[model samples]
Target: MGSSARLRQFVHDNGPLILDGGLATELEAQGAKLQGDPLWSARLLHTNPQAIRDAHSRFLLSGADIIATVTYQASIPGFIRHLDVSAERARELLMSGVHLAKETVTRFDSGHQRPLVAGSVGPYGAFLRDGSEYTGAYAAEMSVEELKVWHRPQIDCLAAAGADLIAFETIPSIKEAEAVVELLREFPDTTAWLSFSCKDGKCISDGSLFTEAVQVARRSTQLLAVGVNCCPPDVVEPLLDSAASLQSPDMSWVVYPNSGEDWNPERGWKTSEKLSATIPELSHTWLKQGAALIGGCCRIGPALIAQLRRELKGDCTPAASAEPS
Candidate 1:
């Protein structure tokens, strides 16, 4: 079977496929200072690639079925502007994100199923580094064609680097979702999944209805899955429930929410006193709701991934429990 087909089949035979936790979260736990860097974790691709490799290795060992490359904020223009590198060199850095993940997968002896590498394609607001990704306020100003133009080079490099699939994650608006779905036609063989960054149970970050966003994603046959990401965990079930009837059978619901904490652009993640449901507990409900691809986003670490694996697989082996830094 082809890689895309394998992904579908895995979900069919197994339950929801376990995706890796936050790359930046793990990197910070390992002592990488990323605050104020426009490139975010992508900067480490040029500065400390081994750190990237090591982070991927940890998730694999923690039982992630798929690990996304650290290219969430990587773009040719961003690299040129921030890293002061030429376009060619910037492209190389983008491709290296995939290479590092592939290399990590190659070296790991999991002795089980091989994990897939997903090329991370974060929203344009991520490149802006102004917290617009959460609001999707920028999408209103950009046309679909213009968004495609900005996203083209990164998509081209990721596909060229041989990612198992593209992960168009944390998209905040239906417009950007439409642009990405349309862009998938250019890479006919590349299968991808589009996940939105939602504000509540029913709406995405731009205040667009999540149901409408899923409809936009449905326009692309190349998209193997569609759902929400980087949003609070509490909202995922209702989002899926509201759009349940609209979901296509062939397209799975891919949900990987954050730790149910709120984000403050100026102060970063706000501390919460209210305890929230763990991923494993919530995942059971998501699986029942037909979420086939599941994992974590911000503040989710390898330890939680390991715990999730054990919970879903019913393994009794002890796993790491260190909280994310």
Candidate 2:
């Protein structure tokens, strides 16, 4: 089946999904930079929009069924706070992120069809300088009143750009997911899915149990799928089990774990140092359990996505070719 049809069917059958991440980190590492700037993406957004689209194309070519656009770091608050860009410019960058996806898809998949665009919605705040922890992540600053004021413009920008579906990712808390859902509700035409970041097994960054986040999301949002991203691959097992324990296996669980082995701010999270091991060679075992949707976080690129495609769908031998454990 075509990618869109396959994705819709995958959602319908509650089958395995292969979604991709790592574009922003990849682009920034390549030539694009996000240093000391929240809206750090704007400088490279339109000029290097293709860099992200290329990452998407790489994933699609590698067998990823879903391609998350390069909007994870493209948040309004981050832009206003860090980039210090005007509202008009921020909106332009956000729309450009969406449009770049379309441009890439049209160019690469014109005749061949098999990849869906997932408009990425990242944290409202920012990741810590160390990269080991997520920092400044608040969906709302004060009351629901305060939250709405913060999220409106960015949410509207993604909707206007015509995202197939919203991918609210890397949320370490339920409140943030709720905030995103609440913002989405304002627009009758928009649809969204929630994904959380699990710390240990039980709680979010704020210490709310993963179940608390999942249950509230299930009850409150019109989330199409729910799972975790941006954590370590090792964390996947417990996070999935936690969700399943909550009686939510029927709903698809999306996963994109960091390939890194160790994450320390001062030590740095260089791509080479991170994924010291090959994925799915070990990860697909989780696929046997749950993990309908899977991909990589920081430092992961086309090769890993390709391996996932082969392991999950085709006849590629994973354990044999992978480096010794």
Highest-TM-score candidate:
1
- Residue range 224-246, candidate 2, lDDT tens digits: 66777777776677777766766
lDDT of 1 at 246: 89
Question: For candidate 1, lDDT tens digit of each residue in 1-325?
Answer: 6556766777788766889999998999899988788888999999999888888888887888899999999999999999999999999999999999998887776566667899999999999888888999998899999999989999999999999999999999888999999998999889999999999999999999999998998898778899998988889999999999988777999989888888876778786634234777888899889888999998888888888888777763233332111
Q: Which consecutive 10 residues in model 2 have the weakest lDDT in total?
A: 316-325
User: For model 1, what is the error of residue 244's alpha carbon versus the real structure, in angstroms, after optimal superposition?
Assistant: 0.5
Per-model RMSD to reference: 2.9, 5.7
What is the lDDT for 119 in model 1?
98
Q: Give me the displacement of residue 90 in model 1, in angstroms.
A: 0.4
TM-score of 1: 0.95
Q: Rate the local accuracy (lDDT) of all candidates.
A: 0.88, 0.64
Q: What is the TM-score of each candidate against the true structure?
A: 0.95, 0.82
Model 2: lDDT of residue 92? 81
The reply for model 2, stretches above 4 Å from the true place, is 1-10, 13-15, 77-86, 110-113, 127-141, 262-267, 270-278, 315-325
